[model samples]
Target: MAATGSRMGVVGGSIAGCAAAVAGIRAGAEVTVYERSDGELRGRGLGIVIPPPLHRRLVGTGYLDAAMPTAPVATRVWLTRVPGERSAREFARQPSAVTPCNWGLLWQSLRSAASGARHHRGLPVLSVGHDGDGGALVRTAGGEESYDIVVGADGHGSLTRRVLAPDLRASPAGYAVWRGTLPVDASAEHLGALQLLRTSWVTIGFPGGHGIFYLIPRGGDAGPDERLLAYAIYATPPEDAPDGAGHVRWLADEHFPQEWADIVARGEHAAMTCHPVVDLHAPVAADPPFLLAGDAAGVTRPHTASGAVKALQDALCLEEALRTSPTPAGALRRYARERTPEGARLVELGRRLGRAQVELTPDWAAMDQGSVDAWCRATLAGTSSYLYADTD
Candidate 1:
């Protein structure tokens, strides 16, 4: 590993930040993660699909088990469309190799890997500056610290992003997402273990949008009879600009269709969360060895569920570049070169997928099914070439 320096600071202690800290520590760096919140993050999501490359990296790093102990392996996908009062079309059992894991479990694994690294809660970064010598200076509520490199894994509304790309702004994709977790027993059809483990059930609406519901098992020791967690994301029109509360109500009242009305109605029963779907024009690469990763760089529509995978990939690629490059700046440049194109590609694919769902015309049912089939086929075939070096 290149000796850039031992002292490093990572802003944000979420999944991306934890992953970056683990990578830095493995590379012989002393890392400290600053989280704005005051407590340990108990990540609460059903599951996230991990692509082959990322899965391999996590397993190799001992962040993941050879076989998932909680969530089942997702080998197939099912897509359906609701037209009128009936099911328009359904595509089932499409072969796929993607593995989905409970988000909370994955976060725990990464947090464990980053055990030695210092994690400071309730320390929100106020500002960041880069010195003429290329070192990063971060000012947080706790005080000030200088680091050889500063990583921004904060999230979509990253303060780091605002400082770097002051002019860049997030424009709504004319839609918002409503997300929540429901009990497994909420729906009789959703009760079985096989149904709850590692499977994604998606339903496209009449307009150019869709709803996805999936399940992931909870505790590692929990039996098949244990309650499975259910999560859903529905794309709906924004109600009042980017106000989170307003969007949540809009999704609950207006956007959801009759079939899913019950789930939407249960929104009040559970914690309903909403956020506007936004993506940058392109991935922004900064100088001074600082760069944006994950949602901070760019976001893909949840229709593809590729955001988490891309973030993990970014961390892996950055780790590999730092390990092989001659200098820190060179490593950062290489990481950008490798990831930017893929990020652009995935964003484009997500847009296309969203449009295919929301903008169907005649033979809409068949068209939707065909689009779903093609997407599953392409993703499963591993046709999307990896732009980064094959370090593994």
Candidate 2:
């Protein structure tokens, strides 16, 4: 192997780090992973979606296990609440198919694939930079290690990215999202409505923002048949907004349909959290020894649903780069050239979605099928996305 003697060090051993380690191992490089958390990372359960083609590619590339559970839906149903109605008005049904998977399950698969790499648990990376000779260095409490290449998956605040683009920063989009998930068994009362989730994901739009609902698999041995109901509500918080969960219910009661409101506001969630919507893109993906992956390279709004997809693709790209390139520097350059433009594209698309769905929202009630299609075409502005079907 061309990379037989290369040494790769990965910082932040979450999904991105683990995937990077897997890429290095597959490329014949000796790898090490640093994880800040000592405990199992499978407990924080979140939901993420990816295109079916990407999912198949990951499984084929051995980044994911073929048996990992997933809940796939074919259509995206956009809904708007009618005044004094128990249900929402369907705005648009796009042929947006996706394979939604359990975040923990996806991470576990990648981590397993990366087990060949030495893993350091409970150790945080304090800093990352290049040595005088262009070898990347990772600094920790134990000491510093020099590697042929360093992969940064340290998330939105990455030390590795700082080495290349220090001036870049994440700018807020002036809204937030309430992320929550509930076991399917617990949502007995909403079973009728949930039937729609089996084949479609729904978007309930209100005056301020919108809520997207879908079903993703639960962790453990739960098969595709057993799933978790997931929802992400994006809206601006009021001055007197309640806590995360409270705020979700507050907005639902006022804006969502009676049935939809009860589904999100009354369900017992297995996990819930709030995240401020922000977008960031690094000027470059690699500066020789230091390479950034996942959020370390860019962070788009959740509206894109490409966060996990991008990380997995980054790993695949790294594997190909190292396998084909003549030298480590060549590999880094190749990976950066392929991914940098993609990061910028995703950031731009995220901002467009955020602006149309939240910031400069239109009167959803007045929008019919033709109007929705026109609005969507303008929002996309010629950018192709997996989330929307061709309306023309």
Candidate 3:
């Protein structure tokens, strides 16, 4: 294996970093991880969804635990609020299968599997670059270290990504996404919405943008109390809008269905936050002693829902490349060749999806399965995605 007996430095200890560490170890490399945050990053984010096949592949490959709790959704229901209507109008339904996971739980699973790596917490990488002799160097507040190869899983503002694609920066999408998780309530009033979540994921459309709602396992348990109602609501936040839950409540109360709005606006969540949507794809995935993965390689709009999926695939592909290549350079070359184009494709797909779903503002109320299929065809523009590839 190309990575056999080699020293691998993986920057960042989140999902991408942990997964990269697992890849390095399995490829016979000695791995070390640098995490900037000293505290547990596990419970920070709310929800993540990936294709069922990809989830299965990660589990089979040992990147995730087999018994990890996940809520698998089979169909996506599109709804739009009708004025003076108590219930939202279900305009379209499609076979959109995915496994929804709590971000914390998923990261914990990966971190456990990658226990072989010496993980350094609260250590921030000051800079990373090629040593110019078929190796790389990572500098931190603690000290500097040299490695046969450095995997920059440090995310979008990565110091390592600058060494490869300094000019690359994420472009804003002129909107923002409000994300949070609500405690699932078993009250009789909310049973309808809760039942809908158990059945399928729902997309509620408004004028400027839309919202996605589903359930994700809270911690590692089952039952209504163990389930959390995770949501991502997108829209152009009006100028001078309130911050935090205030903005979320304003958006929900203004655009979402009554019951749906109540769910997102009802809870006091520690994870409630908002961020502007942006995207970027590195021009190259690797260049010899330096390689990129996850957000370090690219940041697609959340509409694509491929952020974590792309990262897991990166680690899987890296391990495969290193296992087969005769040298580290050869492995990096193969990794770059396969992932660069894929990153570009996902970025392009994300832009198209953003335009169709958010900017262009589709007529959700008028859409049925037929128009929805047509819209999907036009939006996808011949691009391939697991979400639509298997639909009838």
lDDT per residue, candidate 1, 1-392, as tens digits?
66356467888887888888887777777799988978767655556756566677688876555554444344444444444553224444443445556676777778888887899888898887785567788898667888877888888888777766878776656666666665555654523323534354344343445555555555446563344444445455544465455544444344444444555454333345666676663455445457677777778777666787777777777778778877767777887788878777777766655555543312434554456555544443443422111111
Candidate ranking (TM-score, best to worst): 2, 3, 1
Estimated TM-score for each candidate = 0.81, 0.97, 0.96
All-Cα superposition RMSD per candidate: 4.9, 1.4, 1.8
* CA deviation > 4 Å runs, candidate 3: 186-188, 220-225, 242-244
Q: Whose lDDT is higher: candidate 1's or candidate 3's? A: 3
- State the TM-score for model 3: 0.96
Model 1 scores worst on lDDT over the 10 consecutive residues at 383-392
lDDT of 3: 0.87
Candidate 2 per-residue C-alpha lDDT over 1-392 given as tens digits, one digit per residue, 9 for 90 to 100: 55677999998888889999999999999999998889978876599999999999889888899989999888988898896676778878888889999999999989999999999999998988777887988899999999999998989998888889888889988889999998887787876668889999998889889999999888876766788899999999865763457888989998998877887788888989988889999988987888899999999899999887898889999999999999999999999999999999999999999999999889988988888889989999999789885654
Best by the TM-score measure: 2
> Looking at candidate 1, what is the lDDT of residue 218?
50
* Poorest stretch of ten by lDDT in candidate 2: 237-246
